[model samples]
Target chain A: MLDIRQTVEKPRMREKISEFRVGDTVKVSLKIKEIIKEERNKKKGSKEKVTEKEKIYPFQGIVIKRKGGGIRETFTVRKESHGIGVERIFPLHSPIISEIHVLKKGNVKRAKLYYLRDGKKR
Target chain B: MIGLIGKKVGMTQIFSEEGKVIPVTVIKAGPCKVVQKKTKAKDGYDAIQLGFGEVKESRASKPCIGHFKKIGLKPMEILEEIRIEDLSKFKECDEIKVDIFSNSKFVNVQGITKGKGFMGVMKRWGFKGMPASHGTHRKHRHPGSIGQHTDPGRVFKGKKMGGKTGNEKITVKKLSVAGIDLEKNILLVKGSVPGSRGSALFIFSDLNVPVNLQTTQLQAENKPVSVEK
Candidate 1:
């Protein structure tokens, strides 16, 4: 039988993920491939009133919980945009994650910050 | 027709190039040596006998030593014969590594399942036992009935009553070969194989790979796919 440690080392994942715990605010950079938009829409002859603008959506959130082990381990990040809680879970060893930046350390005393969903707790 | 002697090495998770976690059973497969070949004319079938694992000379008895000496090979702890279509392709003492399974997409793992002694119908056969509430007495886990009253006048032949369970040879068919570690002689199967760690398993390369799945030569195409545990 193989030792658990040995099997986990197969095709080793990146060992240096930014270490942040539950309740810590962090920013995660994710690479996304989006299609290009037409730039010629503003040709004065165009009577269409373009009231909405395209804004870049990348890099956000606060680490709420880190669960599981080995390469499957993941952490949940929560961010509030316009008062709505938005949470994202990212695998610690995922190659798709470009970078993890620990913005601030939280002093809360809990393993999982699920209580944050209640919105009133510190 | 291809086979190998592998030790059940337990299980672990591995990440593929695409960064997905796959649960896999790791087995210490051979570095096996072909000991003998059975041909149609001589044995009514063609087969290859493979020897795996090693034991100290003193631990091997005279008869066992004689068997190895007769074939001019070292003593092996496990010896198993696998039916093959051709016997002329191999010679005695030809080293077979984890690589034999490397070319194979799926394998049939034969091992004695873990024994669960004298179990009841509920645990053995998935019988939903009677309720444990106020109305129930000692018949909670008891099997409801064995047979009808007077129809056949005899108990049915293949009734699903519980008796001794497990510790019997089981064949887990169509298990994909997830990975092969030639240096460690280990094989990572995509799913759980019967038996526990340190148990002996006879891993035979499937001869009957469906025509569609065989087009890829059984090698993994996508990275880090989830395997059933």
Candidate 2:
């Protein structure tokens, strides 16, 4: 409802995006490619009905911050993967994203949750 | 590749479909009218002059108004020429909008960079002046030496001495065409282009490169766009 015209020239491109807020837990479905070895090993006569297939890797992270506007907009999602803080920055209007699922919302005072790096948010 | 005369509307951030943050410059381009056409036989070249922006009839001089009337278009403030092999396709009074480069991948943006007042060699030319060490005096920002004094006795022509910097036409080549809004007549080109906001800019697609608007589309389909600004 904000002047969509001012930001993106194509609002239709933005139609697929889901609205979520900061401090929200979200799951991002990322398309990933993995080689199929077993299918390659089987002989041509066997007919396993498979060769290689693209897989979706779900990355669940908390919305630490959402920044920018229009087509240049991006958000940083932080999630502890393997005990290491992994923050993925995704452009909100990009075509690479498959889906964004908002899980839960958090109540915080600051706009940026950078303090989470220090484990203060926990 | 077609080019459009546009005014820099300023810069803003937008989210890609991958939810990545990209810095983009907003440009209000075109809706330009073809002012004149340069033909191979007449001018020994092929090009079309485009007029951009609107001018009030009251502020327009008689000659300028007559010129617009000859072309059957309202008065425009900026006029620029774009070359093409076939000039017959475009005639006077033909309207060109941002849609021409809608699906384009890369564009060459040209503008005059902001001018800085007279500056020293260090900031102006990136000359590493005298070091910040012991026994260094007023020679910090000074030009150590123009040249060997005995041989030439005069500094060579076009030496890298500092004087005025910027305020020159600069062309930013192959800037990605991030997005285009046909309704608003806005064009978003990826990365930083020269000149300040509200300054005039020219957008020309690189004919040699294949436009990959789908790279953005493919990425957008993968990530859901989300932004906070």
Candidate 3:
């Protein structure tokens, strides 16, 4: 019975997910799609047509919290941008995530590093 | 409506061709056998009774075992009747699988929801309880004011109040079919269905609704092509 549940989620599970825990600094490569509008001057009036383009954006941050299990697992990445703390949660098995590269492993006792959110840089 | 008996496996998320995540509920449907077919002349109604989930003969009653024996099929744990306009396609003891839903776009899933025993009006009917603080004393979750003073002096009928909640038959309509696995008899439905995990569900394809063939076409075309080795 458990095997059937696993089989249901097997297709969505990514094969090459990097192993990382809370307090580990990692770089997440996400595929982002942006619509670019170009003006075409065919007649008297100019018409703007939009086209979609895909691009990869890498977000390097420290792992603050990891929640849920199996294919629904999500991790929160916290990073300081422009002297302000920025946090983003990403689904582990999401196809939008192109790659996850573990940069540095931090020594932490607790499972969730939420203290780092408001506390000093550890 | 053509339908089948199924068990709710669980919920999972799948990625679309556009890389958008879609939450889906997996249901292990059919491989159901036609236990009995009711005709208009005989039973005054047109319906096909399908039996699903194999059970031991010892576990089932003598009459149930005898019924399966009459059909020459194994004892089934659940039996459900599906009313169909055309009954010529099915016969007695004919095996029906998840493939029946292959062409179906949307399905209505019926099941008994999980029981939340003796719930309050706040939880059951989403009633706004008493205000907290500002001289409000210990009546935060109370259902304020049932009746007026002495005019009628009785609570009106069909009033939404605190009572037993859930453990009742509920139908979720127009749930799109995400995917179908014929080999394993698994039907992945987009969005949530009622009932807890491992609960029996009646999944029926709406007869009057038009099929969403465009999504199915996109799903088929988006399959990753394998490289020839």
Candidate 4:
């Protein structure tokens, strides 16, 4: 049943998806859109000027878990800032992800490094 | 409105023009053939009959096979008649493709919701069951009360109660069409439709008044409308 579904989704799936797995330290660049509205008092008929800007922000962390399959695939990353652990799940084939750079691959036995959720897990 | 018979091919996500992710359900839509055309002067109504999918000769009745053979067409597995106001351009054996909706921004999909047989009031009707701790025994999932004992005693005819859930025709209106594949006859409708994967659905163009399912019920009450693929 999923075979026909795969055919429709295969083309949309990223061809250059980064080859990385759980416990791998990676930096993910995300695309964010910002809308700025400017008002000008030139004329009564003039409308407000609206501008859209695309920004790329980077989130560097260790891959804690990866789940789902096909275009719906997603992975969770854990990073600590100010002694507080932060985790974000990214859809593996999401267009919002501008780039993914694998920094270091850790030799972890488990597929999901959820133990890191406890904070500073050895 | 004109529509095509389509089979649910499951769902997936695709990037929009602005690089935003959009969830869409892929449907293998027609390539349906106009098997017969009904004229008001002849049949008392103006309509067009369409045939979809193909099957072996042995699977179909001999008379059905002859009917298709008479028109120089292969025996189709499913046949549907749609009441149309404009039938001047269409003719018998004319092919209708998914491209009929190339300019359609949205479509209406109708299908049977996944059936969950005979369920309790709590699951089916969202009725708040009895409290667990307040001296309640075995009526935890029971519906609180029926009505007055003698005055208008019997339960209302259309009262919400525990019974069959789903497995009935439902139309989801105004689902945006995310994409269309003319070559593959695939329609990417933004959002989910009723029924499971491989289930048959009627995709009606937004311009049409969604007469497919309702007309089927009004015309043929005993027969199953769309064939399950």
Q: DockQ for every model, please.
A: 0.30, 0.19, 0.45, 0.67
Tens digits of per-residue lDDT, candidate 2, B1-229, equal 4788998877666665444567787788877888988887899767899899889999999999998898678888988887665567787788898888866778899999999979899997888999787899878887788888677788899788878888999999988887887877888888888888778888887663334433434554886544434
Q: Tell me, by TM-score, which candidate is best.
A: 4
Q: Name the TM-score of candidate 1.
A: 0.79
Best by lDDT: 3
Cα lDDT of candidate 1 equals 0.78
Candidate 4 on A31-68: residue-level lDDT in tens? Answer: 99989998877687667999999999899999999999
Better of 2 and 3 by TM-score: 3
Name model 4 segments beyond 4 Å from true.
Answer: A38-49, B133-135, B208-229
Candidate 3 lDDT tens digits, B25-69 = 999998888999899899987789999998987899999999989
Q: Model 1, range B39-119, lDDT digits (tens) per residue?
A: 879987667889999989899999999989987877899999976555676899988888777777888899999999999
Candidate maximizing DockQ: 4
Sort the candidates on lDDT, descending order.
3, 4, 2, 1
Of 1 and 4, the candidate ahead on TM-score is 4
Clashing pairs counted in every model: 2, 38, 0, 1
The docking category that best describes candidate 2 is: incorrect
Q: Please give the distance, in angstroms, between residue B150's alpha carbon in candidate 3 and its true position after superposition.
A: 6.0
Residues A5-103, model 1: lDDT tens digits: 365454566667777878777888765444454455566654554344433335577677889876667888888999898988777777667778888
Minimal lDDT window, size 10, model 3 chain B: B208-217
Please give the lDDT score at residue A50 for candidate 1.
37
Per-candidate Cα lDDT values, in order, are 0.78, 0.78, 0.87, 0.86
